[model samples]
Each structure stands twice: as C-alpha cells, then as structure tokens.
Target: MKPVTFRNRTWDVAANLHLPADFDPAQTYAALVCVHPGSSCKGQTAGIYAERLAAEGFVAIAFDASFQGESGGEPRYVEDPATRVEDVRCAVDYLMTLPYVDEARIGVLGVCAGGGYAVNAAMTEHRIRAVGTVVAANIGRLYRSYGAAAMLDNIGKQRTAEARGATPLITTWIPDSVEDRKAAGVEDVDLVEAVDYYRTPRGRNPCAPNRLRFTSLANVLAFDAFHLVEDLLVQPIQIVTGDVPGAFGSMQEGRDLYDRVKGEKDLFVIPGATHYDLYDRPEPVARAVGRLATFYRKHL
Candidate 1:
C-alpha cells in the first residue's frame, strides 16, 4: 500500500494505491477504482477491498471523495450526488495516467452508497469495462423514504436560511448509539452493525467522521443512479448483496438494478449476511472479494 494524491477538477483527492506482492512496474496490469460509502472514508471498507483485489493481481485504488476525509473541498462533509459520481470518473482519469495501468481494462467497485455512484459513473464513462457493487443503496430512494412533502418543506427552509448566510446544518447518518437506534425504531441487526463499524474500533478510522451537510439532501433526493441504466449501462455488471433482511433494502435494490441493465450481469447473494455485515466481516468480505476478482478477471 502506498499513499497517492491526484486532482479531481479543483480538489486534491487522497487515496491509497495497492499493488500485488509480486507486482512489476515494467508490466501493465488491470486496475480497479474502489469508491467508499456515504459518511465513510477511503481507509475503511473500500481500502480493505482494494487491498484484497490487489492481492488478486490487480492494481487497485481506494480514494476519499473530494469534500470529505483528507481530500480538498469547501463546505466540508457535503454529500452531493453529482460530486460522488464525478469522483469515480476522476479516479478513472487518474488510473489512465499511470504507465503501469491498462487503460482499456479499468473496473470500478462501490460499496453501499458508493455502489450507486459506481453505477452512475459507469453509465457515461465507457472506460469502465466492468462494474461491481456490494450492498448497493440508491441515495435518491433512501432520501425519498423520508417522505417528499416533509423533505421538500425542510429543503425550502434550509435553502432560505442558506440564502441568509446561515451555516450548513449537519447530521449523522447513523444513530449516536444502539439505544438511540432503538428509540428511533431502527434497532435492527443491520443498523447495529453499521453503527459499530463506523463508530467503534472494529472498523473506525480517523478520517471517517460520519457526518454530512443536511442541505445536501436536496441534491441526493433528485439524483438517481439508475436514471437511464437500461439504456446507458451496457458494460458487464456484478452485484453482491446479503440475503438477510436489513437496513437499506439491498436485496431488492440489487435485483432492481440487475433487472434494468441489458448487459451481462450477475447478482451474488451471501446467504446469511446483512447489509452491514459485508462491510468488514471476514468471511463474507472474503467471499465478495473472490466473486469480484473472478468477474473482473473475465471481463476486464
């Protein structure tokens, strides 16, 4: 693993570059760009998968989105859907510049919300030969779950306040604690696991602060990762999700995305895994990495 920095338009994106143990700079290798989930950083699950994929003989990169983690951007912690999609494309651009990277064989892997961003990126970025997703969650759908009227009303007020020079409101994606989750009617295994992963030592990283600008919801609520998936997503896709019921409704999301794409695709469901279980859990993650490696090997 090595630290790398590259420009994504005006911002400097920070990433970790992972290479196979026997890697030779003299030879070109297929590269995979891994995008992290919302309120998450490149150093968490994305970094883990990038390292695992590198061990499978691919040059891999896990990068921080422009406005979060170590990356440079203003109004920090804003989670704009457009920027997330563009970040993947920017990562691809960085990969194309590498002498040891095969530009024609680039692939993308996105986890959680990042999965949606990956799909969105692949919709227009033809350089992505193959795409893979783990526990995919469409940000637009999730935002809609909050109810349109209430969200629209809140967005109106927030925008008005911003126009008056008020600071951006901030919110955390997960509950502050297990008790808080239970109180909010969200005491499920998936919510608990996600809270632990982001807030505890199990998968915590200093760079992942788990906060987002509340006003950014307006952007996410309007953007759909699969807006034109049926017509634009022509590349092979591989989606991995847990079979168990959990937060984010990943099984149905995976199925919906799989059904829309006309290209060759595969949906691999882990029998007992939940949405968050695949984040850092050893067994499920290993299984997911194997499937991703096999798919990319055949396509990229």
Candidate 2:
C-alpha cells in the first residue's frame, strides 16, 4: 500500500492505494474506492475490503473521509453529507490518474455510513460504474426519526446551538484510550459500536483522528442519502445487510432503495448477522464483496 494525497476540491485528501504484488502496468485492471464509515479511517473495514479486492486483482483504495480520519479539512470532524458524497467524486478523479487503473470500470463499496456516501456518489457520478454497500445506513431516514428517534431531539438541539453562533463544540466520539473503555461498557451496535470500532484498538488505526465536532451532527441531518436513489442511479447496484433482529431496519431501507432502482440491482441479507459483524468479519464481508466484484465484472 502506497500513500497518496487526494483532494475534495478543497483540502488534500489522505488515502492509501493498495496494489497487488503481481500488479501489471501493461494490463488494465478494475479499480475500487472503498470509503470508510463516518468517524472511521480507511484502516477499518474499508481497508479490509481494499486488501481483499487487491488480492483478487483489482486495484483498491481505502481513504479517510474529509473531516474524519487522516484527511485534511476544517474544524475536524465537521462532516457534512454533501461534502462527504462529493469527496467520493473527488476520489474518482484521483483514481483516474492512476496508470494501472481502468477508469471505466471504477466502482465503490462502503460500510455503515460509508455505504450512504458511496451510494450518493454513484448516484451522481457516472464515472463510478457500479456501487455496493454493507451494513448500509440510510442516513436521512435515521436522521428523521427512523429508529431510536429520541436521539434526534438531542441532535436537533446541537444543531440549533451551532446555528446560534455558539462556539463549535467538540464532542468525544470513541473512547480516547483504553481507560475510557474500562469506564464505559460496550452496549448496542449503533453509536457505541461505532465509537468502539473506530476509536478503539479493535478497529483503530494510525491515520484516524480522535476528535469529533458536534456541528457535523447537524450537517449529517441535511444529507438525504437516498435523495437521488430513485431516479438518478443508472449503474449496477448491490445492497447487502445483516439479518439480525435490530438490523432488519437496514434491510428495509435496502429494499426501499432496491425498489427504486432503474438499472441492474441486487440485495442480499446474511441471516443471523448483526450490523457490526459485517464491518470486518471475514465470512459475511467476503460474500458481499464477492457479489460486488462479480456484479461489476459482469456489468462494467
């Protein structure tokens, strides 16, 4: 994996492009840009996906989102839905410059919140020929009182506070250190698991940043992840989700997105798996990525 700096049409984007040991410059290979979930760096599940893809002969990338991880952006963790989605477009622009890449066969795969960002990018960017997601979150639905609706009110207050010109409050996301985890116990798979995986050693990496800005909560609310889901998607799409009890919500969202597709599409529900399980577990993720690569090879 060689490091490169990409941009979001603004600041420099930090990324890792993994080339297989047998990579042949004379041959054009399919490429994939694997986007990390919110608050996570490229080194998490996305990196796992990238490594697997590279092993399978595809040039793969794992990149940090603009405001999170190692990427440079203002007010660290000031993540916005629009900006995050556009970042994918910027990644595609960067991918086009790679000598061994097949620009026409570029695709994207994202996990959790990263899934939303990838879908948004594929909806708007024709350069991305195929799209795939795991533990896909419809950020908008979750924002607009999806499940665990109570949290929205607290988030709304944070938004209002930011709007009133208050100092951008910095909030802690994952446990800052091992001490923090000892103080608090791991609970559900949503926010806690997010903080746990991206912030702790279980999924933490060297490139990720530790601070999260509160204002990003407000910005994420405005992001309708499925905004263009219905009419704008013109490429191959595959949505994979776990079939655990609470995870059914994502399955429903996947179904909703699938029904609106106007092109080649697929949906897979891995039974008895939970949301976080898809993040890095070999079995479920392999199935999803295999389906994704196959879909792209057939379509693009």
Candidate 3:
C-alpha cells in the first residue's frame, strides 16, 4: 500500500492505495473505493478489505473521510453525512485520474456506517458501476432510534455551546476496556462486540480514536442514505451482513434497501456472525470478501 492525496474542494484527503503485487502500469484494471465506518479510519477494516480486493487484481483505495483520521477539515471529527457521501465521489475523481484505472468499471465497497454513505453516493454518482457493503448500517435510522429526545437535547446543548465559542463536544464511540463495556449497561450485544473490536487487537487502530464531534449527531439524524435509492440507484449492488442476534439479526435494513433498489441486487448472509464480527474476524471477513470479490468481478 502507498500513501496518496486527492482534492476534495479545499481539503486534500489522505488515502492509501493498494496495488496488486504484479500490477502493471501498461494494463488497465478495475478500481474500487472502500469507505470506513463513522468512528473508524481507513487503516482499520477498510484497509483490510481494500488490500484484499487489491490482491484480487483490482486497484483499491481506502481513505480517511474529511475532518477525521489524517484528512483535513475544520471542526475536526465532525460526521457530516452529506460530506461523507460526497467523499466517495471525490475518491472516484482521484481514481479516474489514474491512467491504469478503468474508469468505466469503477466500484465502491463500504463497511458498517460507511455502507450507507456508499448507497447515498451511488444514488447520484453514475460513475459508480457497482456497489458492495459489509454489515451495512442505515445511520439515520440508528440515530433516530437511539432516543430521539436525548439526541435532540444534546444537539441543542452542543449548538449553544458552539455559539459561545466553546470547543465542539465529542461523543465517545466505545468503552475504554472490556470491563468498562460490561459496566456501561450496554444491552445490545452488537455494541459490546463493537467496543471489543475497536479497543482490542482484533481491529484497533491509533487513527480511530472512537469519537465524533457532538454536532455531527444532527446531520446523522437528519440525513437518509436511502433517500432516493429506488429512483436514483440503478447500478448493480451486493450487500453482505451477518445474521446474528441484536443489530445483525436478519439485516432488515439490507433487505429493505435491496427491495428499494431499482437495479440488480443481492443480500448475502453469513450465518451466526454478528455485526462487528465482519470487521476483522478472519473467517467471517473472508466469507464476506469472497462474495464481494465475486460480485465485483461479475459487475466491474
């Protein structure tokens, strides 16, 4: 993998390029953009999948979203869903500039929260010929279900604080440790696994500090990643998720999304795997990647 940069308006987004070991500049290859989850960076599961795709002979890229990780933006750690969706387009822009990349066959693969943004981008960006997602989360729905009253109150308080020139409040994405996770009263098993994955060696990364700007909650609550997928997303799509208890149970969101998509779509379920298990767990991730690589190979 090699470090690279691409312009996203005023920001130079930091990204990593994964090229196959036998990559030849004289030969054009299919390309893919991999987007990470909201609280994570490119170096985590995103890089893992990107590198895996590269090994499958596609030129893949994993990038830090604006205002997060190594990327540049003001009001750091802000999770603007609109800007996050647009970042996928910017990634396509950079991929198109590569002489060895097949612009006509460009694809996108997003993980967790990033999956929703990938759907949003494909709804408007026709250059994305195919889309794939792993343990996809419709971020807006999650935010709305997370206690509307409390979320609203927090947003209001943060807005007032920002008005007074106070630093942006940050929301912790995980407990500091396993014991903390157990003590935090987390009823959802998926969230328990989430803390474990982000805080332990399973998929931890220094770049993912497990937090987001408090103001970002407003955008996440307001934006819908599937706003016009039925009308706008006509490209092929494949969604891979686990069928376990809690958030991963049945992947109702993926099923709903597939029904709404007005193009070829498939939902692959990895039996018994939870949401976070697909992040870096070797067996499940390998299964997800196999399905993804096959889908991209057929479409791209």
TM-score of each: 0.97, 0.87, 0.96
Candidate number achieving the greatest lDDT relative to the actual structure: 1
Per-residue lDDT tens digits for candidate 3, residues 161-225, read: 88999877887866877888888787687878888888888778888887788877888888888
Give the lowest summed-lDDT range of ten residues in model 2. 143-152
In angstroms, give how far residue 194 of model 3 lies from its true place. 0.5
Pairwise TM-score winner, candidates 1 and 3: 1
Candidate 1 per-residue lDDT over residues 1-300, each given as its tens digit: 999988878879999999999999999999999999988898999999999999999999999988899999888988998988888988899998999999999999999999999999998999999999999989889878878669888988998998999887888888866667778887667678888888878888889887888888888888888899999998999999999876577878998998888989999999998888788889999999999999999998
Ranked by lDDT, the better of candidates 2 and 3 is: 3
Best by TM-score: 1
lDDT winner between candidates 1 and 3? 1
Q: Ranking by TM-score, best first?
A: 1, 3, 2
Candidate 2 lDDT by residue in tens digits, 170-222: 87656676557657864445555556666667877766666678656666666
Worst 10 residues of 1 by lDDT: 173-182
Screening candidate 1 with a backbone cut-off below 3 angstroms (N, C-alpha, C), the clashing residue pairs are none
TM-score of 2: 0.87
Per model, how many backbone clashes are there?
Answer: 0, 1, 0
